[model samples]
Target: MASIAEVKAQIEQAKQSSQQAMRAVQMLNNQLDQAIQQITAASQGTQHPKVQQSLVALQQAKQKASEVQASIAGGVRSATEYAAQL
Candidate 1:
């Protein structure tokens, strides 16, 4: 029921939001990477199971964030394509 212009505007808004989300996710991942590095450095020459687990957990979280960011980028691309067709 909406006009093409309105739909295009909505799509643009969604794309922008997706971009922002992607940036946020990327920032979080960077922080996670830094944390992982710090933990590794602090635990050098030590064999702590809990520290190992923490590193694994942080790595997994970073991976998941990367996946989420990729998904958001895909959505933004799709929205841009759809808007172009309008």
Candidate 2:
């Protein structure tokens, strides 16, 4: 049987994990925004095939990162809820 202190520790850990996941999501969003700005500037000023390809890659990366972040957030929420119940 786990002690109350152990349960409280677990809850705190869950909260920290959730906060870290949120921070990671924010970082990914920032990167996506920067990538979009780069793409827009490149399109407006000069046309380079390599730059266009990079932009596409960056967009795809952003999409994937978003999905991962969502999944992580969901897991964190679920874990936190479960820990609270304990």
Candidate 3:
């Protein structure tokens, strides 16, 4: 049987974790946007094939990161709700 204090602590931890995940997601999104802009600029001129491939890879990574972020956000929300119930 968990005490009220323990439950509260868990809730606070979950909140902190969620906030961290959100920040990470935001950073990744910004990086992805920058990478896209760079790729676009390179494409306009004499761009190397390797650069284009790298950009594609970056885009894919960004997509994956977004998915992970969504999962984290969902977990955070669920934890919050559970904590409130406690």
Candidate 4:
């Protein structure tokens, strides 16, 4: 088993990693929003099924990204709280 200081260090590292992931997820979501907007604008007059499929995929990706962001935020919070306890 690891010592108390080692455990604390591990928790702190994990918390930092989680925070980094959260930032990345935020950036990804922002980019996806821009892509969706562009896709919508480009497909304004087109009845192509491909466009529809693309939009659907983008929406799905946005949803998944949101979920990931939430998960990462929760992890970061949990890790920080745990490390504080130590």
Please provide TM-scores, in order, for all candidate models, with all chains considered together.
0.94, 0.74, 0.81, 0.83
Tens digits of per-residue lDDT for model 2 on 1-86?
88977987977787797778778877988988897897778688778887788888888888888888788778877877777687
- Which ranges in model 1 have alpha carbons more than 4 Å from their true place? none
Best by TM-score: 1
Higher-lDDT candidate among 2 and 4? 4
C-alpha root-mean-square deviation, each candidate: 0.9, 2.2, 1.9, 1.6
Task: For residues 1-86, write the lDDT of model 1, one tens digit per residue.
Answer: 99999999888888888888888898898899899999999999988999999999999999899889888888888888888888
List clashing residue pairs in candidate 2. Answer: none
Model 3 misplacement above 4 A: 46-48
lDDT of all the models against the reference?
A: 0.90, 0.81, 0.86, 0.87
Model 2 scores worst on lDDT over the 10 consecutive residues at 77-86
Alpha carbon lDDT at 80, candidate 3: 81
Candidate 4 clash pair list: none
* lDDT top scorer: 1
Residue 5 accuracy (lDDT) in model 3: 82
RMSD in Å for model 1: 0.9
Report the Cα lDDT for residue 68, model 3.
Answer: 89
Candidate 4 local lDDT, 1-86, one digit each (tens): 99889998888888788888888988988998999899889889888999899989988998998999888888878877887787
Name the weakest run of 10 consecutive residues (lDDT summed) in model 4: 77-86
